[model samples]
Target chain A: MDRFEYAEARLSSGESFLIREKGVNLYDGNEKTSFEGGEVVLTSHRLLWARPGDIPRGLTCLSLPLRYVVFVEEETGSTSFGFSRSKKIVLHLSQALPGKIPGPVNRSSHHYMKLSFKEGLNSNFVQIINETIQSKKWENFSPAATPSQASDVKLRAGIVGIERGIQEKQKAADESISRAFQDLSKLMGMAKDMVNLSKNISQKIRERQGDITEDETVRFKSYLLSLGIDDPVTRTDFRSENKYYIELARQLADILEEPITDVGGMMALTDVYCRVNRARGLELLSPEDLIQACHMLEKLNLPLRLRQFDSGVKVLQLHSHSDVNVVKNTALALEDQGSLTAEELAQMLGISVLLAKERLMTTEKYGKACRDESIEGLRFYPNQFLQRED
Target chain B: MAEVEWPWQYSFPPFFTIQVHNETRTKQIAAWRSLILDYHKITKHCILDTREAQRTALFNNTAIDRKLPLEGIVTILEDLARTGNAQPLDKQKHRWQIYWHTLEEWADLVYSWVQRCGMMNTVCTLYEITDGDNSADEEFHGLDTEIMVKILQTLEVSKKAELFDDNQGVKFF
Candidate 1:
């Protein structure tokens, strides 16, 4: 657009990065431009668009001053196919100012530009951009002219005015909280925004105070809750069972990969069920459906697999955690200790006694070790039977 | 009898339980068999009562407060019987005749002793062969009479000796 200018990617002293969206296409009015699938970054004073790797390398990029924008509105349209839809944010602009640096285009015919989101528009980005624009902290270019300082100037007139400001802010927070919880549908509609808001709050607090809480369990719980799946695969979404399970399996593998790695590459099926359901939130998956999806993981050549123990306890484990590796490791441990009980192995390996017992049993099953059962509990030793001479 | 020196496995608590694993159980049974034979050879005890074996030093490890249960004792005894180291005396298997040496082995020992003492072609009573001073230093000196008769009968089958008059006497020829 004519309003755009070519500038260095670095932010000015008083400006701060607000939000960024990838896979955005810059549209000049109704016509498309060569700037397709680039990253759009919003700052306190400007919106910058750069090719994927340009900004990181400090290359020249297109920057539009926020002062030139009159208003913004969302535009949704059905493509010609009628099956797929596209979303865009249209920014209306005023007349171009004088003395602007030349950009990708020297002149443009339109007074508006559109950012077509290749991925669906993230509502949180729109909300943040609106707030940044309304704050008008750009009006004063001084480095000390923060929104908090500006608000302090207004409320510092007297003690009563400061008290009234604090009361108004608290009342606004209370109103939003009550409004969000007024109905299930309303809460559901705002769940994504609320989660993003909470995450931002926690991030800021952690940056200032090191951590949000001292309790490890609560911290872990919050961490788990934050790993939410944006779009969970539902059975009703697909016509075929095979397709549904395949998609679900793919999604599950993606979500569980990090967690499984964190907890030693193996997790009980029951535990996995809980974690997946927790991440799914209102989209609760049945145990049967989860097992069905897991069965497809291996067929799909995923890195995860389902294994059942001799005692009928099922678990999900990384393919790297094969039985051969477990048995070999157990054999090595048995040789080192001469003999070991499940409890002792559990202590040594820092795993649950049940999993340790399972490992020992697996070794025994593979003929890598033998067990001694007694009142003290089952113990395993490196198999000397086959190797010993009569 | 001097105190029998037990093997290290005797002190292991899990040695009391009959292992569930097949390979482990086989090894465990072999250990038990050797222990039983060695104990009998040292203490010169010939019989094993299944009900009372649990209380004995052979089956019970008092130091560890562990004892071979009846089922485990039976399993080991059955294994020993299968290997010709022991024989059940009753249909219920509650009573067992433990032979530190097989009947054929015992026959060989007795025949060698008879030849060494120049008792060949000479008749000797079964009691004298077991309790007489001539065999005092022999490993089979306190052999049970029933087992002695069985050993002599084994010799008779080989024509090295003969049992006569209700197995009370044996002639070596």
Candidate 2:
């Protein structure tokens, strides 16, 4: 009755078919022209020949069983289905998965079958297609449970399908990434061991053993980084000019911010150098860079500073009174806003206990700040000095 | 001697110490020496020298009764000798003139007092100022001989007055 059913009964596994279709056709190489009953049919399980044909409205499942084809030719235009009969599975790229519409492909032999790609196909391109397929729920089949096993790892593809020559390059790229990750994994493992090692070193130091090595401090610092200990030092590549100085100042502010009030708001320059360098990803900073940064911060007049007290203890002191912005903010925060404990403020600022303490101490010394004590630790109140006694 | 509180001058610490700092020391010593002259003349007092004064009761830190140490007193005087308010009467004696009021100031005060008492046109002996009934009668009371002579010498030089030896004693006219 129709042009399709006439060829359907006559079609067999050996029969050739013609599909006049124009679009991207995934190929795995082998292609051949076959003559049957005065019809020109191209048999290409591997190669896809795009010819002018009806537009593909939906996906068609064209699966040749695993017993059919012989040698597969993995050429550029190959359709990924060269050795159809091989135990190897053929991945199809047709209309997106989960589209309900049937395939638009028709053989010149007039035989047609709704086409479908292999189940559980998960190439990145297939994913876009499958997401559409699953979203549409195209074919009626039991939903497969778990599809992606490697969602955690993500790396960008180096090259799109340039040709067969470049396809091996993609393979090379994958191998390189795997190698890099293996190296990274080894480093991460060593860092983990050091985390445990540093604890022992701390114990040994307490026991008054021979002093830890000069490098051990750096090693201990490395161990701390591994343990997720965030130090406040930041280092930049040494720059030749003044903007470098500005950058150093900005970075120094961020780094010295928490350490300012650590030792009663004062510390020796040497002690700060050791501690700051230790915390700062173990980066070596020249004294010149540090001094330059300090001078810049002095210029900025930040609440924080490099100060030498009368006792000759050089330390970073955060001046709460000097922090006009912080005082203004805390004033607002404590206005109708209630008093906050150190922990509470740390939580609010998403900072560590050290930073919270420094900020609070600075605020208190500014004299507009006071304290509230409870079962909880000390918290600062707004300068009650601002208000007239009722 | 009984300690006295001053109306305008108070004992501040650096008032005694030799300020090692240049500009500030000069200013500090000046102030202390001036304060010393004023305080001493008003109290009409004497201070022990530094080395010996250390043993005397001073600067007790008693939470009351402010006092100055002998070293502090010496330093204050040294500052004065350096400046010219008072001299080391004898460096060995460590004695000093307490010029709370300068000679000019004292001359003016004495002249005013004598004129008030209507003694201006009259001659008076140095002894009259210390011992005589009328002289001992007022606040312009005691006059040490040396200081009296110095004052008269100062006055005579200016031709404002004259000094003479009389049967009564050395007199100022």
Compute the DockQ of candidate 2.
0.01
Task: Report chain B TM per candidate.
Answer: 0.95, 0.64
lDDT of 1 by residue, A1-390 (tens): 988888889888888988888888999997899999998889999899999989878899999888788888876564424454557888899886544456788788899998888877778877777777788768778735333344444444566577777888999999998877688677666875765676676666556564455685467546645666646788889999999999999988898988888866788898899999998885679999999999999999998998889899898999888888888888999889989998998898777777888998888887777766667667776766534555
Number of the top TM-score candidate: 1
Report the CA-based lDDT of candidate 1 relative to the real structure: 0.82
Q: Give the true-contact fraction for every prediction, in order.
A: 0.32, 0.00
Evaluate residue A356 in candidate 1 and report its C-alpha lDDT on the 0 to 100 scale: 84
**Candidate 1 residue pairs in clash (backbone atoms < 3 Å):** none
Off by over 4 Å in 1: A1-227, A331-340, A347-350, A367-370, A379-390
* Model 2 TM-score, 2 decimals: 0.39
Top-scoring candidate (DockQ): 1
Please give, as one word, the docking class of candidate 2: incorrect
Residue range A330-387, candidate 2, lDDT tens digits: 5566554556666776677665555456566555555545554323446565544334
